[model samples]
Target: MNKNCAIVTGSKESAPYTLIVQTTWIYPGWFAGLMKQHAKVTTLLKFIETANPAHVLLEINSEKAPGDFDFVGIPNSNDRIAEGYAKTAKSLAKLITKKIK
Candidate 1:
C-alpha cells in the first residue's frame, strides 16, 4: 500500500474511502500573482490536472472582513493565529463529515 493509504488505515492496506485534501496557495488576487511570478503556469496546471473526483484542492482566500478570525495576514498576536487555526479546524471538520457521509 502507498504511504498515504498506510497512514489512513494504520496498516499495510489501502483505505476503504480516500479523501485527498490538498491545500494549495491562497487565490484570487495578490498571493496568486506572486505564486505565478515564481512558478510556471504550465507546471501548476499539470499539477492541478492530477486531481480526480476524490481529490479536493483547497485554495484558501482572505476573509471579506479583515477583523474575522479567518483573515489571511500576519496576525498581531499568537491569539489571532490560534483563532484562525480553530476556524480552519472547524471548517475542515465540516468538510470531512460531508465528504464521508
Candidate 2:
C-alpha cells in the first residue's frame, strides 16, 4: 500500500468484513498497469480483479488549491468552513427518546 493517505472502506452496519487501504488516491494510468499485472498473478481460488472492484481517484489536470483544506482561499481569502450537512441535519432530526410506560 502507498504511504500518503488512509482509506477506510466497508460498513460496520452491514458489511461482513473490513478492507482498509492506507494509501493516497490512485491514478487511472497506474491502475491500468495494475490490471495488467493481475492477469499473470492469480490464486487457486480466484483472481483479485474478479473479486474486488478497484478503488481509484482520477487525477484532475488543474491548478492546485492555494491553502490547506478550503479551496476558495486565494491569498487566504478569509473563507469559512462549511458546516457538516449530515451532522447538522441529523442534529435537527434528533427527537426525545423518553419512553413512557
Candidate 3:
C-alpha cells in the first residue's frame, strides 16, 4: 500500500491548488530530480512553493521529463494516497521555503 504519487500546491484556495499534478504513484523526490533535469523550468521548486504551477506542468509529460499526472493504474487511489501525499507535499513545501531564504 504505497502511495507515492502526489499533487501539491502552496495555495489552499481550491482543490487544484497549483499546476502541479501527480497522476501516478511516484515519489516527490524523484519529481524534484526531474525538475532539476529540466533546463526550461527556471525557479522550478520556487514556483511550486509560490504560485502558478501550470507553467512548469507544461513540460511535465514531455521528453524533457517523462511523467504522467493522470492518476492511472492506481487502485483505490483515494485511500492511503491522500494522507501520504499530504505528508510528502507538506515536507516539500517546508524544504522549498527553507531553501528560498
Candidate 4:
C-alpha cells in the first residue's frame, strides 16, 4: 500500500470503520478534444503526466479490503468539476450510508 493508504488503514485502530473514496479522472464529454489538447500541452511542459484510466481502475480495485475498511471509487471526480460535483457527492453519500448500515 502507498503512504496514503497506509495512513488510512492505520486509522482503523482509532475508528471502528474507515471509508476511502478514490476519485477517477474528470468526466469526458463534449470537451474531450479540448481536454486532450490541454493534456498534451501539460505533458510537454512536464506539468503533469498523462493518466491511464485503466490503471486507476485497477488500483482502486486492488486497494479494496472490505474486512479492513470500505472503499469506493467515484469516477469523473478527480477534480471538483462544477458540472458533476453534485452528482458525485450524492453517489458518495449513498455509498457511505450503505456502508454504515
Which one wins on lDDT?
3
In candidate 1 the C-alpha lDDT for residue 30 amounts to 24
Cand. 4 TM to true fold: 0.26
> Model 3, residue 39: displacement in angstroms?
32
Candidate 4 lDDT (Cα, 0 to 1): 0.28
Pairs of residues at least 3 apart in sequence or in different chains that clash in candidate 4: none
TM-score of 3: 0.32
Candidate scoring better on lDDT of 2 and 3: 3
Off by over 4 Å in 1: 1-76
lDDT of each: 0.32, 0.22, 0.35, 0.28
Clashing pairs in 3: 23-69, 23-70, 23-71
Q: Write the per-residue lDDT of candidate 4 for residues 1-101, one digit (tens) a residue.
A: 22212122333334533334443444332223224211100001011112422222211121111111112221232222432433433444454456666
**TM-scores, all models, native as reference:** 0.29, 0.15, 0.32, 0.26
* lDDT by residue for model 1 (2-97), tens: 221212223223434333323333222222322311111110111122325335345333232111233343323444434443444444455445
Candidates 2 and 3 compared by TM-score, better number: 3
- Over 1-101, each residue of candidate 2 has an lDDT whose tens digit, in order, gives 11212333334545433233222222111113223110111111111232343533222221111112323221212221111222222222231112211
